[model samples]
Target: MAITDIPEYAHLTDADIEALGQELDAIRRDVENDRGERDATYIRNSIRFQRGLELSGRALLFGSGNRKIWALGAGVLGVSKIVENMELGHNIMHGQWDWMNDPEVHSTGWEWDNTGPSAHWKHTHNYIHHKYTNVLGMDDDVGYGLIRVTRDQRWKPFYLGNIAYNTLLMLFFQYGVAVQHLELGRVAAGRHPNPDAFKQDLRDVGMKIGRQVGKDYVVYPALVGAVTRSRKTWLRAITATLAANTIRNIWTNAVIFCGHFPDGAEKFTRQDLEDESQAHWYLRQMLGSANFDSGKTLAFMSGNLSYQIEHHLFPDLPSNRYAEIAVRVRALCDKYDLPYTTGPFLLQYAKAWRTIAKLSLPNKYLKGTVDDAPETASELRFKTDPDQRLTATVDPATGRRTGLRTAIGKLRRRRSPVPAIAGQRQAKDVRAA
Candidate 1:
């Protein structure tokens, strides 16, 4: 029941969709043309800052016998890893800084600090995830093939542990990402197409994981133990590294969930991608992604993913430029009367969690119909009455366009006479009917 006709769900005509795409294309061109010194300096500075913080943290860990120093060292290292993973590694591998023609920042050259192989990540994330966005079966990121984040996923007994699964996924997010490309479930079921290729990929992941484990657990701990001549310090060093990696994993998971699984971030069926145009693709990105409010520091920490809508629109654009790009994208959303799905950081993240928690149950236990649920909706929701199907219209008073957002507002009002209960009965009635 996920959206099958995007233009209808968005209440936009073919011409309007094309026009919106043109404006978005223009935004891309402007940013591409304006990429210059400031952008280069920003990335360079980010790299230096991350490296410096990491060194400081490692140095502090040498004195990990002191409790306060151990905590401080772990915290600093965690933040450093977050910055490296989100800002530098993720963006660089997106080809965001490739225009600079600097191999140091090039997508192909930068193997990230995470356990996942850069080559595998590029294929899975940059190519498949971005290209497919939220198309149910196509984008593995739709719950990462673990937890059910949307009702479009048929409920199974396995999903009853949605919250538990998500918590574990959050804690060991890097490992989850590393194994994502392998599709372990398929291989376990003997469904993998190429055994030789799978073996090679598995080797690559194994090597990366070994290197990561050795660097954090063995090499650093052994070095600290030799220098400090204390077994306690060596054990503390390993724990410190563990704490840091856990912090990074949790934070990274939160940011990604906030941008993706929130209420307004709609899912789609493969039918929607059939013969999809550039404009439709842009539209899909807008509808399928969410954002969270953030200041400069928060934005930087999130790799400018606070502007997730814009990032999806122009994945290869300089990450630092997403803030400005968001301004234009929001304006376009206003012009076309589309919803710019965003909210406070905590609120957006909470919504994502709420969806996950609720969707663990079967449809019979849920309140909303498949076509009108908070986490899963389709254009059919607007076609209850064929003569009065919700669509774009012009506001006579202000000469402004009124489309999906306006229609949604009207639908909510119609469903809920009293704000307190807000459509509970109506939704149930609709489901029964």
Candidate 2:
């Protein structure tokens, strides 16, 4: 059961949530007002760097007859693709630079180098995923309709291959993105409401995939082979391109998984969204996303997605500003005593993988209760008096706000016997507001 009562789960009252939302709104306005030539220049420079690196890789692959040169070319190309996909493509399509009014970089005009059609991706990603976020049964990205990442998803025998499915998904992530819009499972089960529309979408996906494959595998290899007049060189060029795409795919998968499926990235239920307010939505975004530690180079390579919480909160903001935005967002978290879910890159990714591995098993075999697991939790986990809504308050001793994070700590420290007598002692320890 995902969290149905977000305010209770967050230990926030209606006033606190609204005030938090106003602060977030102010942050958005500040960023929007601050967008200027500097931001535009940043995006332009990024485009040039990515395109230049890609061109250099292609030139190197022309002489890929040498194995070492082939590897270097592949590595460079892979990095370029990562920048294009993560930083440029993802951001641009999110309408981050729409204010620049540069048609070339506009969300409507720019088509990414991936196999997925930009139009289809915009709908699935920018709209559905961002709006629904971690709401169970709404966000297909929960497990990408494959591996079980949360206990809310029923464990079936098919999930036994969670690790295997994830490996394949990582290696060929672009293909997964390409087919995601089709909802093939529904079509296969004869549940699609409109077969004609599905067919059209499938055809669009096929064309995009075909173009990508031809450019990466056939056209480049043939051109290199014709120039070098060596069969080995042609084959090497194809392999190099394949290696590059694999690198991009694996890195993309890791960064995305780290931001999402890790511990502290909470899940919610549709009931939470019923008449949800702007402030509550902001709270949900904060609770349902995670971040990973990174410096400039690593952050740039990840498209600054290491600050995934900031990105989700202000998806349309310039990606270059996430670091600064994080500073303020963290301060707000501190002010409210909320959990700011973040960790070292490897640790975060490991947590995500760990969740996937553990969730493949039935709930009976798992250690944590459904209500209080690392990957799943509900308002019931707090064990507050149902008659009284607990609100965060300033600690008289420390003058610090004690809220969700503090409550979670208390819950974790409680012994097994504590719950048996929790009701008897609830009034003394758990204050009701």
Candidate 3:
């Protein structure tokens, strides 16, 4: 459903929206001023950890005659690759650490160890994806222009095979990301304005793929073969690299898919973007994001994008600060009666796959969908861990949330814009109507 069509929030005027935006901006300013040695130390120390893992993995790969050792090496190497892509590379390329003023760590000077060109990724991801965010049709990352994610998509018979196609895409996910700047869908649909420009972009992407393939499959493996002198050394080396890459690719696909496609995340129409105020934009960001209520391992693996809403609200803020920022964001949401979409890592991970499988069928057109979600009983209520990271649903009468809600009620009893009597009467009136 269209964003502006939501009558619930119509009570908030443009001035009220702007006031809410100022509160959010205050958080950004406070964080920006406070960033110092600790933030820099985190990034630098993380890079060392990643490099150490890669070196150890390659050293073990040289001795992969033992199947167990090879598996261990591949797992280690996969973690290295994951962190580089997830934490160090992706965040640096977002200009997150640029405030440190170290050229080596600067966005302009840093290049990632991936087939996807850093420049192109910044364009497609940092600029486009973050800017348009979850606005339907505008963001290319919406199913990467392939799988129909929402009911708004015009369906066809070909979508019947999307389950298979999405699986294949995950296996070769890096390759898909590498060529994303090419916008092949537009070219195929004859929407591209200049074929020559697109061809040049494709050629650049081709060179990137060649360099990546050679480094992983040929050069590294050959170095191992020379040291080991086993006839099967080159083969084992190549297999190990492939294994690591596959692990990294699968993880990247999973974490990203969970961020937006998981159960309660919402999407917006073009009209929503056009008429949006700063508060409206923030609201969209909150609705459009789904977070993982996971532990540290998945958090590091996702560059703390596990707090996807926080990332949307403050894209350039240090990721480590997301945990702290989440508390404030949630308080604000609760104050304004907004839904915070999140679940355990496993739950969101599975929900995203379920969304893909469900969308593979023709969208049943008999009923209206609201805010890009079906009118069925799939709405999620979030509950948080003690740290208040969204993980499950709060029963209205129990546990940590009950304590928090009691506090919230005490606070709101004084400041609530609407009277308690009117609120209940309104609810009853709607039911009677």
Candidate 4:
């Protein structure tokens, strides 16, 4: 891809960026060359630990009547599932440890616990999403083709409920992920009329989903209760699985969202990619991603997405190496005067939700960018609305500033000055209509 000509990235010319890419690539090569007994032992031990936790949790659920025991079991099982999906599954499928020459642990050979198949996820996530990063029209991950996370997107009133629906989406996050690759949103919007096109895909994915569901809710519980012929035991096992899955879903969603959508991350239009350069691509990855500040334990849990900048730059690099490169990458960004988007985990979590909440509005700036214009408009700027708040300007169809007239009318009526939307941050140098 031609590097983007965006002036912000001019700090590093195409050649400069290429040299930087070489420097980063050397880091990966070093990790690749050094991969040996230590890496192998680490992964093997992690897997064993996860498996042991899963088994112990299942065993404990047999006597889940003890609230403390059930809590412990569920918590442990959730951690195992999280690690399996985030650290092991995500990294392995990135071909991070493929240098080990171990077939079973290789990206092509390993299967994850999620309902979504690894190959399908790799296609959508690794190939498409990573390649596109934050390109508005191309990247399915920009709001995952769901809620609007940026102001540029032409918004409809439908997004008003995204705050609620997004929560529900998180509750069933794996299910959302399973169908994200299908681009079903396009079908819903009537962009793709041929429903028959994805029939076989549906069957294949359905089987995977079915297998996961059966394992957690059916087969394992059936066996546990079979020995005693106790319906109570079966119910307990089912509940335990539900608990574990819920915890895993919430956590995975939180970590992933925090890395991509938290404050300081910007969204770009497809126009930004015209003649995109390698430097531009690298710049987008850096600017569009964020990290959550965390200690070792939380970093381990996040699959090192807390170092999302490092991961995006060298996706195929082993997870352990990300933390190492992160310090270097941060220094490079600082040298170039680039923004390093990141914050505390809980703080970023709140920002993601705030983004979901505020973006559920008609883009106030849409009039300036989009052709199909609305008649009425206002101008507000964003500064502190958890996420960036809307700042409406004059109507796109007609560059009329009726907002001032309307604001004056409202002032004359003195009908309890419209309490500036609560917790809303007005954009810089912009004001209410």
Candidate 1 has its poorest 10 consecutive residues by lDDT at 383-392
Worst 10 residues of 3 by lDDT: 375-384
- Per residue, candidate 2 scores C-alpha lDDT tens digits across 318-359 of 999999999999999999989999999999999999999998
Clashing pairs in 3: 383-392
Model 1 misses residue 107 by how many Å? 0.3
The clash count for each model shown is 0, 0, 1, 13
- The per-prediction CA RMSD against the true structure, in angstroms, equals 5.0, 5.3, 8.9, 10.6
Relative to the true structure, how large is the alpha-carbon lDDT of every model? 0.93, 0.93, 0.77, 0.72
Off by over 4 Å in 2: 384-389, 396-399, 415-433
TM-score for all models, in order of appearance: 0.95, 0.94, 0.84, 0.80
Candidate 1 ranges with C-alpha deviation above 4 Å:
385-388, 420-433
Per-residue accuracy of model 4 over 48-117 as CA lDDT, tens digit each: 8888988888888776656787788788888889999998899899988888889978999888999988
- What lDDT score is found at residue 92 in candidate 3? 89
Model 2 residue 199 distance off true place after TM-score fit, in angstroms: 0.7
For candidate 4, which ten residues in a row score worst on lDDT?
A: 375-384
Number of the top TM-score candidate: 1
Clashes of 1: 0
lDDT (10s digit) by residue, model 3, range 283-318: 667767889996777788899999999998898898
